[model samples]
Target: MKKIRKSKTEQLNFGNYSFEVIKKKIKNIYFRVYPSKGKIIVSAPFSIDSETLNKAILSKSDWLNKQVKKAAIAKPEPVKTYITGEKLLFKGEIYSLYVDYRHTGPRVAKTFDKVIHLKVKPGTDFPQREKIIISWYRKELKRSIGMYIDKWQPRIGVTVNEFNVRKMKTRWGSCNVNAKRIWLNLALIKCAEKFLEYVIVHEMIHLLERKHNARFKSLMDRFIPDWKRLKKELNRFSL
Candidate 1:
């Protein structure tokens, strides 16, 4: 039987580029670049020495430089103020918002021509209004997540114990394989429904394979043939 090496992480600096290197029991080295901040991460096998790793990184300097340049000039999304006539993203579609101050509980509804109607009590402040919209997003996302779980659990042949939604800064979703629980990012509600489903399926797959290895990629291909594309598209959105 083959033994797996325990993974360890360390920081490496090469001139202007710094990388977070994780030495794991893996066959090949992998590089990931975060376009938003030009962060680079390298996953290398435990057997690789620092000299070899440095050489490998140097070979990819051109590609890394291009990615960092793009990040330097990247434009960030505008901050939302949750006001009337402001465009909001939901299910990958943008909708113009209409705020209605009524003597009623906070409610949100969608009407014709891609418009979202948000009804709140009179004298509601900005934070209050934002809270109301967030509450509505959570409710709708939960409802849809329940339906997707029901639909995919049978096909995937995995029984999830439970799932939760919350605001996550880094990850779209995560699965606790032993507990059979999944956590989805609350921000997913703003993207397309397909993106949400992709995240769900990705987390569920972790129940079967804990690591993102060849076996995991094979399983993803079997389930979501275009998952590579979906993943690329989904990452284009900020957390």
Candidate 2:
């Protein structure tokens, strides 16, 4: 099921960022820097004022700066027609799409020549074509992440009970530390293997450190020194 995104109650500008301040029924203030373009969101109690909310978001300027930089690199994708001669992003490289219609069912394949061969049933519509491509992406992502987990689980000193691949709008991946399970975004198949490894290590590290604090960063540095840069690169193109 899809989640209903909470509506924004107000918006404010602070420093180099324009963020939304949402007044919720909750008790405490919540600050969030979304992975996509590093959107800043602050969820606060209804009793909070504009000045207080501004100050709260301002205090995290340094963190917000990095998020803004990441956001700046993002390029929104144009509406897709799923037609011939279109380009597809896969493994950090763009592939020329070749649509074929001589198959009983839709299937996708990539060639060493950097071409994506999509063989679908004759005269498929846009939605069916999209479903075919997405299904292919999911299958490939699952296979790829399985290999990554096998390689990293021993190195990261963690055991994963299960791994799932699905469409996640806000995050590339998530971890269930208690269950030793992880969920990876279906869009990850579009990223390079190095960036994919970074995400895998990131979620695995969460199994050790539940919070993104000093120790969490220290571990990321130890594992992938240029993780921050790769993160920006990964978000350079919108899914």
Candidate 3:
């Protein structure tokens, strides 16, 4: 097997380290070391300077190495293939799809057996099909957000005054601490049940911890021990 190498020009530093210059359509950076071996892997923008990035990574080498090891032992990524007739997860259960072409416009209706039935006109284009599905997703998110907020408010001991759903580019959810409100990305409706719960719990926890600091992680760990795993799984899905 080929050994992974670090850029020699990169510098190393110490402390709770993170690279500042890397950005992606996906907000977070992913770190991985092949076959459960080698230095910490940091996936960031290609333009970042190797020297400065290396220094930051080295600063938090101990913590970063532990995370890499944990990732190695973590469960394999969930199978999230997007194929016809495949069942999708909602809340915490499987909801199969039955695609049909009777409706003039694309529409989605819930079946008696908890399945989502999508009605598309014959020969509908991909963009049209996607729009219909996404519209349904937004509706599902709006319908479900209230219930999650109600369930988690008491658990976390924080009451969110208001919340809304929309298409978010960077995160699955965000909270306004000052306004006591939360906003969720409609894309979450397509993820696993546990992943949905993780996002909800994550946002709700923010009412108590405004920043992603130690206390925030502690809260998440207390509520969702498998959050890190769920996060990795969520990333495997298309937004």
Residue pairs of candidate 2 with colliding backbone atoms: none
Best by lDDT: 1
TM-scores of all predicted structures: 0.68, 0.66, 0.53
Alpha-carbon runs more than 4 Å astray in model 2: 1-73
Rank candidates, lDDT, best first.
1, 2, 3
**Predicted candidate 3 versus true structure: per-residue lDDT over 1-239, tens digit per residue:** 99544322232333543332323334334555443333444655444556755665666577666554444333243453323575655543457767777747567877668687778778776677667777777778777778777888898999989988888777888889899988988767755456767888898898998999999999999998989888886764545
Q: What value of lDDT does candidate 3 attain over all alpha carbons?
A: 0.67
lDDT (Cα, tens digit) per residue for candidate 2, span 1-239: 99655544787777777777787778888877775544678889877777887787778778777655444335555577788888777776678899998856678899988899989888799999988888888888888888989998888789889999888888888999999899998778877788788888899999999999999999999988999998878766465
Question: Of the pair 2 and 3, which is ahead by lDDT?
Answer: 2
lDDT of 1 by residue, 25-133 (tens): 8998898887655579899998999899999999999988866643432324467778898877777667889999999978899876899999988889999988989
Residue 210 lDDT, candidate 3, scale 0-100:
90
Per-model root-mean-square deviation over C-alphas? 13.3, 12.7, 13.7
Where does candidate 2 have its weakest 10-residue lDDT segment?
Answer: 69-78
Better of 2 and 3 by TM-score: 2
Q: Which of the two candidates, 1 or 2, achieves a greater lDDT against the reference?
A: 1
RMSD of 2: 12.7
Local distance difference test, per candidate? 0.86, 0.81, 0.67
